[model samples]
Target: MSFNPDILDIISLTIGALLFLMVLVLIIVFALEKEYYAVRKSLILLLFPAFFLIMPFLNFPYQDYLLLGISGLISLAFIVLVMPFNNRKKISDYTFSNKVDERDIMFSRIRLEEGTENHNAYYTDRPRNKEIDDAIKANPSLLSEGSTYYNLFQFASANASFDTVEAYHDHLYKDPAPVKKDVDAKQLSGYIKAWSKKLGAVDCGITELKDYHTYSKLGRSHNYGSDCKLDHKYAIAFTVEMNKDMMAAAPAGSTVMESAFQYLNAGSIAMQLAYFLRSLGYESLAHIDGRYEVIAPIVAKDAGLGELGRMGLLMTPKLGSRVRIGVVTTNAPLNIDKATFAPDVIDFCRICKKCADCCPGKAISHSDRKNINGDIRWQIAQEECFRYWTICGTDCGRCMAVCPYSHPNNFLHNFVRKGLRNSYLFRRFALKMDDFLYVRKPAPGSPPQWVKKNS
Candidate 1:
């Protein structure tokens, strides 16, 4: 069929509109970086679209068909050239044999009361921890002014959420009646994912429970004298994204606000999942903030969710460390994804030690991953890290803010993430580029202007 002028005009208008939108997006992204030269270069690229839009109006010697063909080819080339690198390896390749002890986590230890048998047993098993444990005990606790920027109001506000989560702990561990009907694993999995998403989960995955993911002894529960044993067969893990704007204001009221917000989100999802499993005639437990039996990150990692980065937090492909995780352990039979590790994250973290450099307490490790609990991993000094938080009266999330992966979940940041995943060469290049665009030790940014007066 022969192409008509009206048809050509319509095609030109659509392409022009799309091109303009793309340019506008690029401009805004570049503006966020505060880099003038990059913005200028991106603007210069807009010339091609500007010419195309004007060319449609001009009665040049060139045929419309030829012009259309050339424009289409140019657009195709641009897409190919601009496509971000994506080097994601199979989830199986990153799996490690390492097992995690639930007793080693700070939450578990914090749940220990002085002179408790579990606390005594923990120190006996790992005597070296006593000195560090003593150090934490000596500090002005969370919500106390002994912290660096302690704000009683903010700390208490954050604590209120934790209080609500505590109210759900007992309800999670209850057993349900047996179901007469056979349970469909696939259907149940789909229902859980949908419900989790509806409850504000950013991502969800299932994995078989491993010995290392559980604590050796019960540290947090009233059964503090009992040995820790999670006999559950499967674990359901999910993540809730943290707000970039709020987190950027690290060591401030806004940072605490974001932390509490996600904790509540994650907690709610876990509680619902546990309750749902009960309705289905199964026993399950929700491990939300402050209440836990299993380590959520380890389970999430095994479930092919993401890697653990330098800040000792899950670095999901989409949200990085700027997220909170919740887990539900159950006896239900289900398909599970083998734990996957992302070496690119490790490589990037090795070079990009922004968290270590920015930490106010210098608690994050600057050295390589060490042997801890029979696993090769970087160990942050938990006592020092928590002490800093107690002093600051905030979670002291400067590390989360400075992480290159903690950028806003927008197209611009996703483009960079795609590059980091696809090519080793691009991973190295993008790490340096991230440092350039966002400083290696970015200053703690202020909250939105509107929040300042009220805050």
Candidate 2:
């Protein structure tokens, strides 16, 4: 083939046009999503066309070879960028040594009345927690009158939702009449999952119960400090979506209201599921917010719902950490789902510390994940977290609100989730984009219309 300058010029113009069009499309996409930083970055990518167009006009010696060399380098870079070489996030190889103690948790400790046997027994065993626990005990309580972000109606609404959850707390356990129904394991499992989703759950799965899933002791109501000895064969886990708009007002009363509301939604689904299973003539127990024998995140993880993220929350594919989890344990025969190990989820969490950065109490760890008991997982400082909740009169969901994974489930965000799930490079790039496109310290949004109106 002869080295014709006209042919080279045509090639250059064609390449430049395609590059320009691609950048334009990207800018439009970002703009439509109201992603200012993404639009800005895409506009900068207009430089991609500079060399292809200007190089053709440059009177360089051996221009054809120069263009070929540039093209080869660009193509190689493109391949490397898009390659799926990142390791799939594997579930931590480490497992918990034993069951967790509910009494040791902040919530359980908070409920301890001062100068009582329950209080003395706990403080005597772990004196270190005494000072801090008491400090939290003195703070303005959650949704209290004088606390930050307290609105008369908002606090009342949250309290009402919590009160409703408390009502269901005592109803978690019940005896089965008899084994009246001889059901196929797979069929029953399918029915339960479908029924859960129909009851407003976003996702549901079943996992064979594990020893580590049970708490070592009860923490709430009259059963405080009693050993939790649940030995169910299977666990049904489900998640309900927390409203994105309401969540945007995190660290405020609206977030607490949303949290409490979702707790009820998830709890209702769980209790109904458990009741249905028991009616089949098998033992079943609902694990709601206040009366949980098993760890919901661990159960959800094993049930294939989602993987645990850096904030010690279940990061579901659709809703990330923005969903509330509920579980039901039963002896009824049912199929179990295999948990997925998306190393990319871990990889993303390793880099994106938005949740940690936004935590008011500095409760979330900013360091590399550590070994807890035996499990290699991120351990959040429960005392600090709950203490902040008491002070703010809210659940202090700043971490959840700022989490990169907790974005609204729309096409633009879901596409990013897919990238985070599929490629390591994309996950790394996505975190950078998230920080750039969203913000390092995003301002909390306003409360919902209902909340505002009531206020």
Candidate 3:
């Protein structure tokens, strides 16, 4: 049998390219800090490409055409998988129909002491939550000595971070700016975004402040049940990267430490941004730590930061649910972004329930989106989740840890993300591939060396 020289060159090129990709994938897996995945990817990449290269010599009938057919098929499959076609024209499906009460949130509920006036008033209004809230409170608390995975040093460190964040509560509120400078909204918005990144934020976005973004009432610390009335016209939302190593230790002390630490980082950036805006005479309020008037995720989504996921958290394109968000609600004239339709991510969430499966608290809903607070979205079992956090002496980020989307943000993972966005078939194949390479429930990675040595 004879083949054209051009056809031969094409085959050789395809084989050589795939062989190179195989090595590239191996290096990528290693760079992503995935040992098991590196091994599995290396074998698969090597074997599959080698099969294509050695096909002509396999002594099969019409081996030359068989190789061409196989290579063509592979190319066709790649083309189909990388094509972007989805619900881009549709309106965003996750918009809230109404505002959420700050008091209704678990963090707010946890602050209320039983027998106190606020507690009685709240429990009386929502009798259904009393029993659940009480049960959660009865557990060994978060960052406490009696809880599981309670490392004294780690808890102390996490506590210290939270304490600093709380201390910044007063800093969020500033006196009128003495030097009000005339600033360009577009340039200022650009400056804010760039400066936010300089201050450790991974992403920054702006949105028109909405009634839904603000909490209905005050629920934390002093001034409980007070009206959280703020007429801020614009909001700045940003996300900060949570260390992959720390987050991989999900449902463990390291996860809590990391969460708390990132909260501080986010808070710090928010505080700085707010201060900067206010210095220019804008009425900026940094919503951080335990003092929040805005629903951070909602505000972030509105700001084009990310889409809301099944776990009821912001799933950023880069970090998935592995990042913590911070917000600065202000009267600054910053450019606002429109809500982007991310049905691909939504579709992926519908299929990928790895978070729900791994959730120690069984907090994440496995079922499809339902009418929650009048919006079509997934609702988590808040009381159940808080109870597990209390049990672990940590936030128990197993959902974030096991999430396939929460893989490290790099070329390899980003390429898979792009594929998922582009093709539903690739999304399904990627999920299966994810399971094959990393398994559904990978063991919690060991804590950082500093944590281990100290603990």
lDDT of 3: 0.84
RMSD versus native structure for model 3? 2.6
lDDT of 1 at 160: 83
For model 1, the superposed segments whose C-alpha errors exceed 4 Å read: 1-24, 30-104, 108-127
lDDT of 1 at 118: 76
Determine the C-alpha RMSD for candidate 1 after optimal superposition of all C-alphas.
6.6
Q: Would you list the C-alpha lDDT of every candidate in the order shown?
A: 0.76, 0.84, 0.84
Q: What TM-score would candidate 2 get against the native?
A: 0.88
Reference-based TM-score of each model: 0.79, 0.88, 0.93
State, as a TM-score between 0 and 1, how close model 1 is to the true structure: 0.79
Per-residue lDDT over 1-455 for candidate 1, one digit per residue giving the tens place of the 0 to 100 score: 55345777767766777787887787788788554445666676577567667665767565587668967896775565456544444222333455445577665676677897777888898898888777776777666677665655566767787777777766766767667246888888888888899889988999988887776655556655466567889999999998877777798877887788788889888988888788878888888776677777778888778988777888899988988899999987677866656777887777788899999988999887766655677768877888687667788789998888987777888987876765666667677666655667877887656556664
Per-residue lDDT tens digits of candidate 2, residues 1-455?
45456877887877778888877877887676555666887767789787787876677689889887877787786676567766753534434557888899888888888878998998899999999988998999888987888888888889899899889876777888665689999999999989899999999999999988998888875788788778889999999999877887888888988999999999999889888988899999998888888989999998998888889999999889999999999999999998867667777888888888889989999887787766788889998899888888999888888888887687767877877776777777778767776777888867777777878
- In candidate 2, how many clashes are counted? 3
